[model samples]
Target: MRPQRLSDVVGQQHLVGPGKIIARMVAAKLLSSMILYGPPGTGKTSIASAIAGSTKYAFRKLNAATDSKKDLQIVAEEAKMSGTVILLLDEIHRLDKTKQDFLLPHLESGRIILIGATTENPYININPAIRSRTQIFEVKPLTLTDIETALERALTDPERGLGKLPIKLDDDAKRFMADATNGDLRSALNGLELAAQSTPPAEDGTIHITQAIAEECFQRKAIAGDKNGDAHYDVISAFQKSIRGSDTDAALHYLAQLVAAGDLPIICRRLMVIAYEDVGLANPPAASRTVQAVQAAQQLGLPEGRIPLANAVIELCLSPKSNSAMVAMDAALTDVNAGHNGAVPDHLKDAHYAGAKKLGHGNDYKYPHNFPNDWVKQDYLPAGLKGSEYYQPKMNGRFETQLAEQYHRLRKANQ
Candidate 1:
């Protein structure tokens, strides 16, 4: 019921194609435990099964969600009896500590070769101990052409497919099914089977499948994402990074993915953070615009809200990036954490009350407005930290460049 050869596996050519990592390992019979991660129905299980079949290894499939520790024991025992066992663990991201503890020894001993399959990002969900022992390959979504090919294979193949039935599917119907499934071959195949089986045969004993039947069989494919899962974080992270990296195209792509996932609040918050943290003083206006956009998104809500969010994302991505403010804050924090708590200069201390003048507060504090250019050379920092320069703005954008120039001129004049 699944692909027996790597060559027959649809999509994920990056891992299973000729001369690819999986193909090379299989060809050399040098199998290693690995994790296949991606969206649902992307051949994770099929690829694992194919590897097991090709290598002639005893294959066992277990669902991490339902399978207990005893199931792992059985697999381990079987592996001990029969050289090695290829264990395909589904929902591996949900693997508990107890199961991980039980499986680690067998994995290290080569008695169990784990093929972990997860719809979540393993790096974010799986235990590092388990992850370190296996190679991780991301299986991509199947293209429409790939889905069509698989559908065709299922339609004509006699033994495991629907070939036994005299079914006639129109070209448009095939395209509809392939496109409707949204790169999920399993959905496409299931829909095909449904249409073939449910439709009554005509006088010629041939079951006719039309686009309407295909649509009825399969609903629109839901967006391949969970708002609270690894995909959510991954997409948001990509969105922020793309904006920071100033890749408008990539930023928009990730933004769309998040919007499709319906996590508008998270996207809005992340955009605000990106504007200030990444786009900082380089374009202060961008940061203000990002705040306004987030406010607009909050007020407008979904569907319409995405408009302002998109505007903010594109504007932030195009804006000049500068991390000098972040760097400066971090540098200051580093000094503070490293026991640099020098007392504030007496003159700089608050001296609002009448008695405060007796403590030398504001005794010699020079008012900058009283001097030429509205600036004055004064030791503002505590004595020991007078010359310590935490903020060194980069000449990246017009605003930061002007600030940097003024900063240097002030430092020189003060010296």
Candidate 2:
């Protein structure tokens, strides 16, 4: 059931709590268009509706991906008559250019206090025009305590929630629902409803929702998500760490958990990242194979796709790990970002132009390929960073060891 007041909304205290941004905005009567982004069942819709209810404004909810431009025009027309209307635009990231252009002027005039909602990150997926005009607020997953509170509220509230029904939710069943939901309050409520409706009324006319009933209502998700879904982010974090730590068993365990949750894309993407970020230059070939494996997994889909993914995960686990490449690149980036850049040497500058010789470009440049060893030592870095070194080989793998030997030899030759 949707909440009519912010007080009834669960979790997301950072945005809706009494001194928070949303609360402060509503208090000061200075409502600005904002975006609420997070995973499913995080109360993004509830907050939007609650704000509208509290402000006594006409609340309109529409999916940007499914609703037509005419649907938005209807809301705009209503806003024109009502002075201001609160619109909860779901899947705002999918809003097309035409619909966005139509809504832009209304948002600008404060006639439509748009509350855009999406599971995707607004900064990455939303159009710049809409994003620039709206404030972005992240709705966090509901905690177990938060879910329990909502469940209890639903059980007792006579209106909106299932209160009139004689439902008895056991403590174990309530906890099971909360833990199984993985912070998704909507899933928990839906599962509870299914259990309540499916179970036969007891002799006392009470619908008993026991732990077994909860499990049965949840089906495969109940048992499979027992260990994984409760801590989805934790499982993902542990999955990468286990691989990086070379714990093949632990890594595979987490992989299985992610698969059970049906998060193939996240698994594939994370595996690719782990290949480069964790099992990096120490074994370049392994990293390359990980990318190929991710591509194969994407094509194959789950079940069969998991086969190549398993191979990649195991190889990455056993592969030698080195962050030397990542570290070196980060070091260079840090300097560049901090404005450590200096003027390039004239000899190293482009010398293909007609007046190159006159400008002293490439005049003193030595052609390394023409030298005795097919190499020549020269200042390639800018004058201020002439002796700067970034690449530090860990030499964990044979390939890196050999490369390190050659690298040190060349440095010695120059010295």
RMSD of each: 14.8, 7.5
lDDT of 1 by residue, 227-285 (tens): 22244356778888899888999998988776764567578878888988999999999
Residues 108-187 of candidate 2 have per-residue lDDT tens digits of 99999999999999989999999999999999989989999999998998887889999999887888788777789999
Q: Report every candidate's CA lDDT.
A: 0.87, 0.88
In model 2, which regions exceed 4 Å deviation? 143-145, 170-172, 179-182, 221-301, 321-415
Q: What TM-score does prediction 1 earn? A: 0.59
Please report how far candidate 1 places residue 252 from its true position, in Å.
17
Which window of ten consecutive residues has the lowest lDDT sum in model 1?
A: 220-229
